[model samples]
Target: MTTGSQRTRTVLHLPCLGPDAVPLERAVAAVLGYARGRRWLRFRSPGRPEGRWVRVPAFGWARFDAHPPSTGPDADVLIAEGLHGRLDRTGWHAVHDALVGLAPVVEAVGARAAGRPFWELPADEFSVLDEPGTVGALLRHLGQEAGPHPAHVLAALHHRHPDLVPHLTPTTRRALLPHVEEGDSGVEAVVHRELRANAGAFAELEAAVAAVVGDARPGRLRLHDVLLWLTTTLRLAHAVELGEHVAG
Candidate 1:
């Protein structure tokens, strides 16, 4: 589809990076640990025709996306293109800061796009996925326009957040985009149980992320994202072991 910017865009779910033996989740945590203190972190104005300077995080994820295929107008794509060199030089920690700085703008885009089908929003708005808490707002903002698969909210969160990237990677949004969306009691129960069981771990991860990002802890939706990601990863892992794809 063409983005509102009128640029043709395609969305693709790339395979998780790195060796199969090292789960994506664990690799990201390690990247964060390595990046702490040693890397430069700052929020800079997004670059335009010629960019400004910013320190990049040491993580490969940042550097990698900083140079995505030159075909999309999504926010993350634009941001990545804007910060291409800076990200390559600097890395994930800096990219994380950039995403955080971009959060409000992304949310604003969602607010404007509210009540419209997601695809109808400007392509740049899809970049909201790269930020921490905007997708839920986007989904809620979508209201009736969220269509038949609001569980795609989980996919959005997983796509954006580094911590959830590998573990919850979906080759296609359709894989996780629920047909009958939820508000169902069964869904609520599962959410509650996952939250309870993983509360301590989530707390630790949040604290770690907060410390690294130099911000208040991420919002509730982002936290819930962790739980949803974990649940999805477990299912996906099982499917992999069974030599079958996850059921859409």
Candidate 2:
């Protein structure tokens, strides 16, 4: 790995498509397995605003998702896996803020995609770990002695299962590409321009709605606004909010 600023790390998605595409459950299972049974790795997915907070024995993780390169231990090396139609930067940022582990920056990386690749909307900056396979490298980075994490095992199993592989399409491919390259190409530039234009339209609509509510709905409108921002962040490719439909 070419050394950059060790203090300031950037997060990138793992590019391995994986056999049949492994489900995140399997992948997380692999992470647990690697703990060498030393600590208890619990994935706490509460059905409330608090969401899930995964704890591995001595490793205590807070339940907030923050932006990439988290400055505090609250969010150390984060691994953002799998994104759907929207990136949900807002939710991911929340996740990053909540993350607290051994690493410094809390971010996530994965190739969990549906219909097409989820590339365009990534953390601040990204690159596809295409060469030696992202999972293997991650193991090495975490220390080869520990072995595979339960998450890794689960992911591999999920890959073998045909039900997990998400289909691909031009849109997904386009969405994911911006995240892997070192720099934005001409195509990416055009897409950014169009997305900016759309942002203005969305902003106008939001203003109109706020005006209509006019304190009548109060928290309802505010809550909708929050959701809208989260939705916007998702669209921007910060984090994948899979919990809206899937409870755990």
**Best by the lDDT measure:** 1
- The candidate 1 region of ten consecutive residues with least summed lDDT is 10-19
lDDT of 1: 0.34
Model 1 agreement with the true structure over 1-248: per-residue lDDT tens digits: 12223211211111221112333233224323322212355555545535445665443234332233332223343343332233333343444444444455445644564655332333333333443334333433432232232223222222354231211223222223442134322122222333344444444544544544443344323444332343344433332232211111
Off by over 4 Å in 2: 1-69, 72-79, 82-171, 175-184, 205-248
Q: For each candidate, how many residue pairs have backbone atoms clashing (under 3 Å)? A: 5, 59
Q: Write the per-residue lDDT of candidate 2 for residues 131-155, one digit (tens) a residue.
A: 2433223322322221223222221
Q: What's the TM for model 2? A: 0.20
The local distance difference test score of model 2 is 0.27
